[model samples]
Target chain A: NAGVTQTPKFRVLKTGQSMTLLCAQDMNHEYMYWYRQDPGMGLRLIHYSVGEGTTAKGEVPDGYNVSRLKKQNFLLGLESAAPSQTSVYFCASSSRWREGVNEQFFGPGTRLTVL
Target chain B: AQSVAQPEDQVNVAEGNPLTVKCTYSVSGNPYLFWYVQYPNRGLQFLLKYITGDNLVKGSYGFEAEFNKSQTSFHLKKPSALVSDSALYFCAVRESTSNTGKLIFGQGTTLQVKP
Candidate 1:
Protein backbone atom coordinates (compact mmCIF):
# COMPACT_ATOMS: atom_id res chain seq x y z
CA ASN A 1 0.00 0.00 0.00
CA ALA A 2 1.13 3.48 -0.73
CA GLY A 3 1.48 4.40 2.90
CA VAL A 4 1.54 8.07 2.07
CA THR A 5 1.91 10.17 -1.08
CA GLN A 6 2.39 13.89 -1.67
CA THR A 7 1.60 15.86 -4.76
CA PRO A 8 4.10 18.11 -6.58
CA LYS A 9 7.43 16.93 -5.26
CA PHE A 10 8.83 20.41 -5.88
CA ARG A 11 7.30 23.83 -6.26
CA VAL A 12 8.31 27.47 -6.61
CA LEU A 13 6.00 30.30 -5.69
CA LYS A 14 6.24 34.06 -5.76
CA THR A 15 5.51 36.21 -2.78
CA GLY A 16 1.75 36.59 -2.20
CA GLN A 17 1.01 33.59 -4.42
CA SER A 18 -1.16 30.90 -2.90
CA MET A 19 -1.12 27.12 -3.29
CA THR A 20 -2.32 23.97 -1.62
CA LEU A 21 -0.33 20.83 -0.98
CA LEU A 22 -2.15 17.55 -1.16
CA CYS A 23 -1.38 14.48 0.93
CA ALA A 24 -2.98 11.10 0.48
CA GLN A 25 -2.58 7.96 2.50
CA ASP A 26 -3.99 4.50 1.88
CA MET A 27 -3.26 3.04 5.30
CA ASN A 28 -6.56 4.13 6.79
CA HIS A 29 -4.76 6.01 9.50
CA GLU A 30 -6.83 8.11 11.86
CA TYR A 31 -4.21 10.78 12.36
CA MET A 32 -2.52 13.02 9.79
CA TYR A 33 0.01 15.81 10.18
CA TRP A 34 1.80 18.51 8.21
CA TYR A 35 5.31 19.62 9.09
CA ARG A 36 8.02 21.84 7.65
CA GLN A 37 11.70 20.94 7.76
CA ASP A 38 14.22 23.74 7.69
CA PRO A 39 17.95 23.19 7.80
CA GLY A 40 19.07 22.50 11.38
CA MET A 41 15.58 23.29 12.69
CA GLY A 42 14.33 19.72 12.17
CA LEU A 43 10.66 19.22 11.51
CA ARG A 44 8.09 21.49 13.11
CA LEU A 45 4.41 20.72 13.03
CA ILE A 46 2.26 23.18 11.16
CA HIS A 47 -1.09 21.51 11.58
CA TYR A 48 -2.66 18.15 12.25
CA SER A 49 -5.96 16.27 12.06
CA VAL A 50 -7.11 13.69 14.53
CA GLY A 51 -9.83 12.48 12.22
CA GLU A 52 -11.89 13.48 9.29
CA GLY A 53 -13.42 16.95 9.40
CA THR A 54 -11.14 17.97 12.22
CA THR A 55 -8.02 20.11 12.29
CA ALA A 56 -5.86 21.73 14.94
CA LYS A 57 -2.99 24.20 15.15
CA GLY A 58 0.50 22.93 15.90
CA GLU A 59 3.75 24.40 17.15
CA VAL A 60 4.24 26.64 14.12
CA PRO A 61 0.81 26.96 12.58
CA ASP A 62 1.14 30.57 11.48
CA GLY A 63 1.11 31.29 7.71
CA TYR A 64 -0.41 27.90 7.05
CA ASN A 65 -3.87 26.36 7.00
CA VAL A 66 -5.01 22.79 6.75
CA SER A 67 -8.14 20.77 5.98
CA ARG A 68 -9.01 17.12 6.44
CA LEU A 69 -12.31 16.79 4.71
CA LYS A 70 -11.81 13.10 3.97
CA LYS A 71 -10.41 10.22 5.98
CA GLN A 72 -7.57 9.53 3.56
CA ASN A 73 -6.56 13.01 2.54
CA PHE A 74 -5.07 16.07 4.25
CA LEU A 75 -4.38 19.37 2.56
CA LEU A 76 -2.08 22.23 3.58
CA GLY A 77 -2.71 25.64 2.10
CA LEU A 78 -0.59 28.76 1.99
CA GLU A 79 -2.71 31.89 1.64
CA SER A 80 0.20 34.16 0.86
CA ALA A 81 3.55 32.60 0.31
CA ALA A 82 6.62 34.32 1.65
CA PRO A 83 10.37 33.68 1.44
CA SER A 84 10.39 32.48 5.01
CA GLN A 85 7.90 29.79 4.06
CA THR A 86 10.39 28.12 1.76
CA SER A 87 11.28 24.74 3.16
CA VAL A 88 10.77 21.02 2.78
CA TYR A 89 7.24 20.06 3.77
CA PHE A 90 6.37 16.59 4.95
CA CYS A 91 3.15 14.66 5.41
CA ALA A 92 2.72 11.86 7.88
CA SER A 93 0.01 9.52 9.18
CA SER A 94 -0.42 7.04 11.95
CA SER A 95 -2.97 4.90 13.68
CA ARG A 96 -4.86 6.00 16.79
CA TRP A 97 -2.72 6.78 19.81
CA ARG A 98 -4.32 4.29 22.22
CA GLU A 99 -3.73 1.36 19.90
CA GLY A 100 -0.11 0.94 21.03
CA VAL A 101 1.24 2.27 17.74
CA ASN A 102 3.11 5.55 18.10
CA GLU A 103 5.38 5.56 15.07
CA GLN A 104 4.45 7.88 12.24
CA PHE A 105 4.89 7.06 8.53
CA PHE A 106 6.19 9.89 6.37
CA GLY A 107 5.90 10.49 2.67
CA PRO A 108 8.52 11.85 0.28
CA GLY A 109 8.72 15.53 1.14
CA THR A 110 7.68 18.42 -1.03
CA ARG A 111 10.39 21.05 -1.45
CA LEU A 112 8.99 24.56 -1.73
CA THR A 113 10.82 27.74 -2.61
CA VAL A 114 9.14 31.11 -2.30
CA LEU A 115 10.77 34.14 -3.85
CA ALA B 1 4.59 22.81 26.71
CA GLN B 2 6.34 19.71 25.40
CA SER B 3 9.77 20.11 23.86
CA VAL B 4 12.73 18.08 22.61
CA ALA B 5 16.38 19.03 22.24
CA GLN B 6 19.40 17.65 20.41
CA PRO B 7 22.31 19.32 22.11
CA GLU B 8 24.85 18.68 19.38
CA ASP B 9 24.51 20.26 15.95
CA GLN B 10 26.74 17.56 14.47
CA VAL B 11 28.49 14.34 15.50
CA ASN B 12 31.49 12.85 13.77
CA VAL B 13 32.76 9.31 14.16
CA ALA B 14 35.09 6.97 12.32
CA GLU B 15 33.70 4.02 10.47
CA GLY B 16 33.24 0.90 12.63
CA ASN B 17 33.44 2.99 15.76
CA PRO B 18 30.65 3.38 18.28
CA LEU B 19 28.38 6.35 17.83
CA THR B 20 25.94 8.20 19.98
CA VAL B 21 23.42 10.94 19.31
CA LYS B 22 22.10 12.64 22.40
CA CYS B 23 18.51 13.73 22.96
CA THR B 24 16.49 15.12 25.86
CA TYR B 25 12.86 15.92 26.29
CA SER B 26 10.36 17.60 28.61
CA VAL B 27 6.66 16.95 28.90
CA SER B 28 3.87 17.43 31.38
CA GLY B 29 3.25 13.69 31.57
CA ASN B 30 4.85 10.51 30.33
CA PRO B 31 6.66 11.02 27.05
CA TYR B 32 6.62 8.84 23.97
CA LEU B 33 10.03 9.47 22.48
CA PHE B 34 11.11 8.63 18.94
CA TRP B 35 14.11 8.82 16.63
CA TYR B 36 14.06 9.34 12.88
CA VAL B 37 16.76 9.52 10.22
CA GLN B 38 16.73 11.50 7.02
CA TYR B 39 19.08 11.09 4.12
CA PRO B 40 20.00 13.98 1.90
CA ASN B 41 16.98 15.14 -0.10
CA ARG B 42 14.74 12.44 1.39
CA GLY B 43 11.92 12.10 3.84
CA LEU B 44 12.41 11.21 7.47
CA GLN B 45 12.49 7.50 8.30
CA PHE B 46 11.39 6.13 11.65
CA LEU B 47 14.19 4.54 13.63
CA LEU B 48 12.93 3.63 17.07
CA LYS B 49 10.57 4.64 19.84
CA TYR B 50 10.35 4.40 23.61
CA ILE B 51 6.85 4.03 24.97
CA THR B 52 7.06 1.55 27.82
CA GLY B 53 8.89 -1.53 29.02
CA ASP B 54 12.67 -1.93 28.74
CA ASN B 55 14.65 1.26 28.75
CA LEU B 56 16.69 -0.05 25.83
CA VAL B 57 14.58 -0.12 22.68
CA LYS B 58 15.85 -1.55 19.40
CA GLY B 59 14.66 -0.46 16.02
CA SER B 60 15.31 -0.41 12.27
CA TYR B 61 18.79 -0.40 10.69
CA GLY B 62 20.66 -1.68 13.71
CA PHE B 63 19.88 1.35 15.82
CA GLU B 64 18.86 1.41 19.46
CA ALA B 65 17.96 4.02 22.03
CA GLU B 66 18.19 4.09 25.78
CA PHE B 67 15.41 5.90 27.59
CA ASN B 68 16.55 7.35 30.88
CA LYS B 69 13.65 8.73 32.84
CA SER B 70 15.78 10.20 35.61
CA GLN B 71 17.89 12.03 33.10
CA THR B 72 14.93 12.80 30.86
CA SER B 73 17.02 11.68 27.94
CA PHE B 74 16.66 9.23 25.06
CA HIS B 75 19.95 8.89 23.26
CA LEU B 76 20.37 6.91 20.03
CA LYS B 77 23.33 4.63 19.72
CA LYS B 78 24.89 2.09 17.41
CA PRO B 79 27.47 -0.57 18.09
CA SER B 80 29.43 0.39 14.99
CA ALA B 81 28.94 3.30 12.66
CA LEU B 82 28.76 2.96 8.91
CA VAL B 83 29.35 5.57 6.24
CA SER B 84 25.79 5.03 5.15
CA ASP B 85 24.71 6.09 8.62
CA SER B 86 25.78 9.61 7.84
CA ALA B 87 22.54 11.51 7.83
CA LEU B 88 20.37 13.89 9.78
CA TYR B 89 18.84 12.58 13.00
CA PHE B 90 15.88 13.94 14.86
CA CYS B 91 14.41 13.33 18.28
CA ALA B 92 10.76 13.86 19.03
CA VAL B 93 8.38 13.50 21.96
CA ARG B 94 4.66 13.19 22.40
CA GLU B 95 2.93 13.67 25.69
CA SER B 96 0.94 10.68 26.84
CA THR B 97 -2.01 12.89 27.67
CA SER B 98 -2.24 14.22 24.15
CA ASN B 99 -5.17 12.58 22.41
CA THR B 100 -4.31 14.38 19.20
CA GLY B 101 -0.97 12.51 18.87
CA LYS B 102 0.99 15.68 18.22
CA LEU B 103 4.78 15.52 18.40
CA ILE B 104 7.42 18.13 19.30
CA PHE B 105 10.68 17.77 17.42
CA GLY B 106 14.21 18.93 18.22
CA GLN B 107 16.67 20.76 16.09
CA GLY B 108 18.26 17.93 14.10
CA THR B 109 21.76 16.57 14.65
CA THR B 110 23.91 15.69 11.67
CA LEU B 111 25.78 12.40 11.94
CA GLN B 112 28.92 12.08 9.86
CA VAL B 113 30.59 8.70 9.69
CA LYS B 114 33.93 8.84 7.91
CA PRO B 115 35.23 5.80 6.18
Candidate 2:
Protein backbone atom coordinates (compact mmCIF):
# COMPACT_ATOMS: atom_id res chain seq x y z
CA ASN A 1 0.00 0.00 0.00
CA ALA A 2 1.22 3.45 -0.80
CA GLY A 3 1.04 4.99 2.67
CA VAL A 4 1.00 8.60 1.53
CA THR A 5 1.60 10.14 -1.89
CA GLN A 6 1.86 13.68 -3.30
CA THR A 7 1.47 14.72 -6.90
CA PRO A 8 3.71 17.00 -9.02
CA LYS A 9 6.99 16.38 -7.31
CA PHE A 10 8.34 19.67 -8.67
CA ARG A 11 6.80 22.84 -10.01
CA VAL A 12 7.73 26.42 -10.83
CA LEU A 13 5.31 29.33 -10.51
CA LYS A 14 5.53 32.98 -11.30
CA THR A 15 4.54 35.63 -8.81
CA GLY A 16 0.76 35.97 -8.44
CA GLN A 17 0.25 32.51 -9.96
CA SER A 18 -1.96 29.94 -8.32
CA MET A 19 -1.46 26.21 -7.97
CA THR A 20 -2.63 23.23 -6.00
CA LEU A 21 -0.70 20.43 -4.33
CA LEU A 22 -2.51 17.14 -3.88
CA CYS A 23 -1.96 14.67 -1.08
CA ALA A 24 -3.53 11.22 -0.71
CA GLN A 25 -3.31 8.53 1.89
CA ASP A 26 -4.72 5.03 1.82
CA MET A 27 -4.41 4.36 5.55
CA ASN A 28 -7.85 5.76 6.42
CA HIS A 29 -6.35 8.36 8.72
CA GLU A 30 -8.55 11.05 10.19
CA TYR A 31 -5.91 13.74 10.51
CA MET A 32 -4.03 15.48 7.71
CA TYR A 33 -1.65 18.42 7.62
CA TRP A 34 0.32 20.66 5.27
CA TYR A 35 3.75 21.94 6.21
CA ARG A 36 6.50 23.89 4.49
CA GLN A 37 10.20 23.31 5.12
CA ASP A 38 12.59 26.19 4.78
CA PRO A 39 16.23 26.62 5.57
CA GLY A 40 16.75 27.21 9.33
CA MET A 41 12.99 27.52 9.79
CA GLY A 42 12.11 23.91 10.43
CA LEU A 43 8.65 22.94 9.23
CA ARG A 44 5.89 25.46 9.59
CA LEU A 45 2.25 24.44 9.61
CA ILE A 46 0.25 25.76 6.70
CA HIS A 47 -3.09 24.00 7.22
CA TYR A 48 -4.70 20.98 8.77
CA SER A 49 -7.85 18.86 8.66
CA VAL A 50 -9.19 16.91 11.56
CA GLY A 51 -11.53 14.97 9.32
CA GLU A 52 -13.10 15.06 5.94
CA GLY A 53 -15.09 18.23 5.21
CA THR A 54 -13.35 20.14 7.97
CA THR A 55 -10.29 22.31 7.49
CA ALA A 56 -8.52 24.75 9.76
CA LYS A 57 -5.88 27.45 9.42
CA GLY A 58 -2.45 26.84 10.81
CA GLU A 59 0.49 28.99 11.83
CA VAL A 60 1.46 30.02 8.30
CA PRO A 61 -1.87 29.94 6.49
CA ASP A 62 -1.66 33.43 5.08
CA GLY A 63 -0.88 32.42 1.48
CA TYR A 64 -2.56 29.03 1.42
CA ASN A 65 -5.93 27.36 1.43
CA VAL A 66 -6.84 23.78 2.10
CA SER A 67 -9.78 21.55 1.22
CA ARG A 68 -10.53 18.14 2.64
CA LEU A 69 -13.54 17.00 0.70
CA LYS A 70 -12.61 13.31 0.75
CA LYS A 71 -11.37 11.11 3.55
CA GLN A 72 -8.24 10.11 1.66
CA ASN A 73 -7.37 13.40 0.01
CA PHE A 74 -6.15 16.75 1.35
CA LEU A 75 -5.32 19.53 -1.05
CA LEU A 76 -3.31 22.69 -0.40
CA GLY A 77 -3.77 25.64 -2.68
CA LEU A 78 -1.63 28.68 -3.26
CA GLU A 79 -3.69 31.74 -4.19
CA SER A 80 -1.37 34.37 -5.63
CA ALA A 81 1.87 32.72 -4.84
CA ALA A 82 4.86 34.70 -3.66
CA PRO A 83 8.55 34.06 -3.47
CA SER A 84 8.15 33.52 0.27
CA GLN A 85 5.79 30.65 -0.49
CA THR A 86 8.41 28.84 -2.53
CA SER A 87 9.49 25.97 -0.35
CA VAL A 88 9.24 22.20 -0.05
CA TYR A 89 5.70 21.38 0.95
CA PHE A 90 4.87 18.18 2.73
CA CYS A 91 1.59 16.44 3.48
CA ALA A 92 1.28 14.16 6.45
CA SER A 93 -1.34 11.80 7.87
CA SER A 94 -1.70 9.98 11.14
CA SER A 95 -3.95 7.14 12.24
CA ARG A 96 -4.36 8.90 15.57
CA TRP A 97 -4.27 12.40 16.88
CA ARG A 98 -1.12 14.48 16.53
CA GLU A 99 -0.72 14.26 20.30
CA GLY A 100 -0.40 11.29 22.60
CA VAL A 101 -0.62 8.84 19.73
CA ASN A 102 1.08 7.40 16.70
CA GLU A 103 3.51 9.43 14.64
CA GLN A 104 2.63 11.20 11.40
CA PHE A 105 3.47 9.58 8.06
CA PHE A 106 4.68 12.17 5.56
CA GLY A 107 4.39 12.23 1.80
CA PRO A 108 7.33 12.47 -0.59
CA GLY A 109 6.96 16.30 -0.66
CA THR A 110 6.57 18.74 -3.55
CA ARG A 111 9.17 21.38 -4.32
CA LEU A 112 7.69 24.66 -5.50
CA THR A 113 9.79 27.53 -6.75
CA VAL A 114 8.16 30.91 -7.23
CA LEU A 115 9.95 33.51 -9.25
CA ALA B 1 2.00 26.87 23.21
CA GLN B 2 4.23 23.89 22.71
CA SER B 3 7.58 24.24 21.00
CA VAL B 4 10.81 22.39 20.35
CA ALA B 5 14.46 23.33 19.97
CA GLN B 6 17.26 21.55 18.14
CA PRO B 7 20.27 23.36 19.52
CA GLU B 8 22.80 22.30 16.91
CA ASP B 9 22.69 23.09 13.23
CA GLN B 10 24.43 19.80 12.49
CA VAL B 11 25.96 16.76 14.09
CA ASN B 12 28.83 14.74 12.66
CA VAL B 13 29.60 11.14 13.47
CA ALA B 14 31.67 8.43 11.91
CA GLU B 15 30.28 5.11 10.78
CA GLY B 16 30.19 2.49 13.59
CA ASN B 17 30.21 5.28 16.17
CA PRO B 18 27.46 6.39 18.47
CA LEU B 19 25.55 9.55 17.71
CA THR B 20 23.26 11.92 19.56
CA VAL B 21 21.01 14.71 18.37
CA LYS B 22 19.87 17.05 21.12
CA CYS B 23 16.31 18.33 21.52
CA THR B 24 14.50 20.34 24.16
CA TYR B 25 10.90 21.45 24.54
CA SER B 26 8.52 23.70 26.40
CA VAL B 27 4.78 23.39 26.99
CA SER B 28 2.13 24.48 29.43
CA GLY B 29 0.77 21.00 29.97
CA ASN B 30 1.71 17.47 29.18
CA PRO B 31 3.82 17.44 26.04
CA TYR B 32 4.02 14.89 23.27
CA LEU B 33 7.38 14.84 21.58
CA PHE B 34 8.38 13.35 18.25
CA TRP B 35 11.44 12.79 16.09
CA TYR B 36 11.49 12.79 12.29
CA VAL B 37 14.15 12.36 9.64
CA GLN B 38 14.16 13.96 6.19
CA TYR B 39 16.41 13.12 3.31
CA PRO B 40 17.23 15.46 0.44
CA ASN B 41 14.11 16.27 -1.54
CA ARG B 42 12.03 13.86 0.55
CA GLY B 43 9.30 14.02 3.12
CA LEU B 44 9.88 13.83 6.85
CA GLN B 45 9.77 10.24 8.09
CA PHE B 46 8.63 9.32 11.57
CA LEU B 47 11.51 8.10 13.67
CA LEU B 48 9.94 7.91 17.13
CA LYS B 49 7.62 9.59 19.64
CA TYR B 50 7.07 10.15 23.35
CA ILE B 51 3.56 10.24 24.71
CA THR B 52 3.17 8.95 28.22
CA GLY B 53 5.42 6.12 29.21
CA ASP B 54 8.97 5.20 29.94
CA ASN B 55 11.61 7.82 29.50
CA LEU B 56 13.24 5.85 26.70
CA VAL B 57 11.40 5.35 23.41
CA LYS B 58 12.64 3.13 20.64
CA GLY B 59 11.54 3.55 17.08
CA SER B 60 12.12 2.63 13.44
CA TYR B 61 15.57 2.23 11.83
CA GLY B 62 17.22 1.44 15.14
CA PHE B 63 16.75 4.97 16.41
CA GLU B 64 15.74 5.89 19.95
CA ALA B 65 15.11 8.95 22.08
CA GLU B 66 15.21 9.73 25.75
CA PHE B 67 12.54 11.84 27.38
CA ASN B 68 13.62 13.76 30.44
CA LYS B 69 10.89 15.50 32.33
CA SER B 70 12.86 17.82 34.52
CA GLN B 71 15.10 18.76 31.68
CA THR B 72 12.19 18.96 29.26
CA SER B 73 14.27 17.28 26.63
CA PHE B 74 13.85 14.44 24.13
CA HIS B 75 17.21 13.65 22.64
CA LEU B 76 17.50 11.21 19.72
CA LYS B 77 20.28 8.64 19.82
CA LYS B 78 21.69 5.75 17.86
CA PRO B 79 24.20 3.21 19.06
CA SER B 80 25.88 2.88 15.69
CA ALA B 81 25.74 5.19 12.74
CA LEU B 82 25.53 4.34 9.06
CA VAL B 83 26.45 6.49 6.08
CA SER B 84 22.87 6.14 4.91
CA ASP B 85 21.72 7.63 8.21
CA SER B 86 22.90 11.03 7.12
CA ALA B 87 19.92 13.37 6.91
CA LEU B 88 18.09 16.24 8.56
CA TYR B 89 16.52 15.49 11.94
CA PHE B 90 13.65 17.41 13.43
CA CYS B 91 12.14 17.51 16.89
CA ALA B 92 8.48 18.32 17.38
CA VAL B 93 6.09 18.80 20.27
CA ARG B 94 2.33 19.11 20.72
CA GLU B 95 0.38 20.12 23.76
CA SER B 96 -2.34 17.85 25.07
CA THR B 97 -4.91 20.62 25.23
CA SER B 98 -5.93 22.36 22.03
CA ASN B 99 -4.18 19.70 20.05
CA THR B 100 -5.75 19.94 16.63
CA GLY B 101 -2.96 17.45 16.14
CA LYS B 102 -0.74 20.36 15.20
CA LEU B 103 2.96 19.87 15.71
CA ILE B 104 5.52 22.61 16.41
CA PHE B 105 8.85 21.67 14.89
CA GLY B 106 12.45 22.56 15.67
CA GLN B 107 14.94 24.20 13.34
CA GLY B 108 16.35 20.77 12.49
CA THR B 109 19.83 19.27 12.86
CA THR B 110 21.73 17.84 9.96
CA LEU B 111 23.32 14.50 10.83
CA GLN B 112 26.28 13.55 8.68
CA VAL B 113 27.62 10.05 9.13
CA LYS B 114 30.95 9.66 7.39
CA PRO B 115 32.44 6.34 6.47
**Candidate 1 docking quality: incorrect, acceptable, medium or high:** medium
Candidates' TM-scores?
Answer: 0.98, 0.96
Instruction: Summing lDDT over every window of 10 consecutive residues in candidate 1 chain B, give the lowest-scoring window.
Output: B96-105
What is candidate 1's lDDT per residue for A25-110, written digit by digit as tens?
99999999999998878888999999999999988999999999999999999999999999999999999988865789999999
lDDT of 2 by residue, A34-56 (tens): 99988999999999999999999
Q: Which ranges of candidate 2 are over 4 A from the true structure?
A: A98-100
Candidate 2 reaches a DockQ of: 0.72
In terms of lDDT, the poorest run of 10 residues in model 2 chain A is A94-103
lDDT (Cα, 0-100) at A88 in candidate 2: 93
Structure candidate 2, residue pairs in collision: none
Model 1: residue B5 alpha-carbon error in angstroms: 1.0
